[model samples]
Target: MKNISMKNVVMGSVLAIAAVTSLSANATPVCSGTVAGNGASFSAGTNFVKVAFTPKCSANVFLDGEETSPTVFRVGSASLKGKTKFGGSSVGGSVGNMGACTGAGGVCSGTDSAAAMTAASS
Candidate 1:
């Protein structure tokens, strides 16, 4: 009887662990293209880390073209690849070490060129 009880406990523990691991992977986080812009940033506070994103072109984008970004931001670095969807397209993401953010900039640069090309192509 003791042997059977021990086995049950061990099996329960294993199942619990597997369940937790599965949930962790699925809970990574997700965001829509609500918040898009140049020099946009988010911080997990000191507890997690500070994350920032910069644009290389004219980027003053808004979520759904509204006027703000999403409330929850899931940033990824080169070492920690992430995902993002914007401008009716899904794009990959990358974030670096947590520190003073010197992200990209282009609120009025290549972005203009991109828009022009897009218009011409259309």
Candidate 2:
């Protein structure tokens, strides 16, 4: 996959799982954190990546910027791999051989440096 600059938006409910697939390049995916909720994890393979998250309803966040995938928020899992803001400011995109993905909703893994932002929840 190749990294492609894009501007996308991911909005959905925070009481389940949402998968936002938006990355064409197979590089290391990074993100940040702002709000808190349920459990969220990230995983990357050779062909694709998985973002398993569990929202619990809290606040609204507007990732005013590049967004990949169509924004999937369920209770099981989701994925991204094309071009966008990854997930939010806390979802430390997928990285090498995968990292110790965090399940905390209001936290970042990489360099996304997340702030106390707000997003619309369902």
Candidate 3:
């Protein structure tokens, strides 16, 4: 009985350690601070890349000065993508007359340093 209990504890510890490590490794790009805006992540394949964002703003997000794919269309929360080697993807949010990608009125705004293309998972 004692041996079995010891084994169980060891196994549990290993699993816990693995879970923590995996979570840290798989952590996606995060955005935080005075703006209190959204978070973003990406999954990339050979032919295409998929990006998703959690909208915490009152407006839309823009990519490369354009309001289109890979950004929410005039709303909150969005998922989109682009082809491989999509180039540098600059991120910003538009909330009313809040300027270009500038977070205001309880919205968070900033540019993501993430690659336009990344690995299979963030």
Q: Residue by residue across 10-49, what tens digits does model 1's lDDT show?
A: 2232233222221111112212212322322333333222
Off by over 4 Å in 1: 22-122
Query: Candidate 3, which segments miss by more than 4 Å at Cα?
Result: 22-122
Q: Evaluate model 1: give its lDDT.
A: 0.22
Stronger candidate by lDDT (2 vs 3): 2
Query: What TM-score, over all chains together, does every model reach?
Result: 0.19, 0.17, 0.19
How much is the lDDT of residue 82 in candidate 1?
Answer: 13
Q: What local lDDT score does residue 13 receive in model 2, on the 0 to 100 scale?
A: 27
Q: Residue 52 CA error for candidate 3 (Å)?
A: 24
User: With candidate 1 superimposed using the best TM-score fit, by how many Å does residue 9's alpha carbon deviate from the native?
Assistant: 0.5
Top model number, lDDT: 2
Q: Where does candidate 2 stray beyond 4 Å?
A: 1-11, 14-19, 22-36, 50-122
Local distance difference test, per candidate?
0.22, 0.25, 0.24
Q: Per-residue lDDT of 1-122 in model 2, one digit per residue for the tens?
A: 13221111122321112234322222222221335343233343232335432234222222222223333211111112212222332233221111112325422223221111112111
Error of 2 at 18 (Å): 5.7
The predicted structure with the larger lDDT, 1 or 3, is 3
